[model samples]
Target: MIGRLNHVAIAVPDLDAAIATYRDTLGGEVSAIEPQAEHGVNTVFVTLPNTKIELLGALGENSPIAKFLERNPEGGIHHLCYEVEDILAARDRLLAAGARVLGSGEPRLGAHGKPVLFLHPKDFLGTLVELEQA
Candidate 1:
């Protein structure tokens, strides 16, 4: 089962510009950029009162975000992350319910250093969903 909403991820073509928009323009507290090579993304988290916003930039040409940016030059909301008490259990439940899990069907270390799994976008009404362990 899903818990609380974690963070919404947005893919940006320019990471520095996005960070400035959130930090300077929006007056949000932005965290330092962290390059997640495993995930092929450079991330910056914008902290908010209720939840956080994840700014994702392509780490390399092969990055998945690069493909996303190709389709959407301006970038946009990429995924919605939700917390789960037990990620493995949640995966099993979703599998039994006919939902498709992305990648190797295993949880990976997310930006928050928590175990995270991504579900197929098609399975979630064309919206990519990420499950992060609480």
Candidate 2:
């Protein structure tokens, strides 16, 4: 089962401007900012009560988010991340339940610097799911 609705990732073309807009105009506070070197993307996390807004964009050609932005203009919501007590357990259950992993099972430093993984949305009925261990 999911522990909490951790964060919602929004793919934006301009990370800085998005940060400014969310902070200055929308009144959100910066929670965590990290560079996902593996994914070739930089992220800015804006925190709100009971939820977070993650601003994601590509830093290089290998970024998947960059490709997503290409097809869809006006950079929008990417995926939903939920906090789980055990990522491996979740993965195992998901696998047994007919879900497939989009990437390797190895953990990567996520938005909050915690380990995370993305489950293939095709297997999840079009909802990209992120499994994160707390």
Candidate that would win on TM-score: 1
Q: Find the candidate with the highest lDDT and give its number.
A: 1
Residue-by-residue lDDT tens digits, candidate 2, 1-134:
89988888889898888888899899889745588787678988887887888899788778978778997667988899889998888888887988787777776777567889898988777878887897
Give the alpha carbon lDDT tens digit for every residue of 6-108 in model 1.
9999999999999999999999999999999888999999999999999999997689888789899999999999999999999999999999999999898
| Per-prediction TM-score to the true structure, in the order listed | 0.95, 0.87
How far does residue 78 in candidate 2 sit from its true spot (Å)?
0.5
In TM-score terms, candidate 2 sits at: 0.87
**How far does residue 95 in candidate 2 sit from its true spot (Å)?**
0.7
Give the whole-model CA lDDT for all candidates, comma-separated: 0.93, 0.82
Displacement of residue 95 (Cα, Å) in model 1 is 0.6
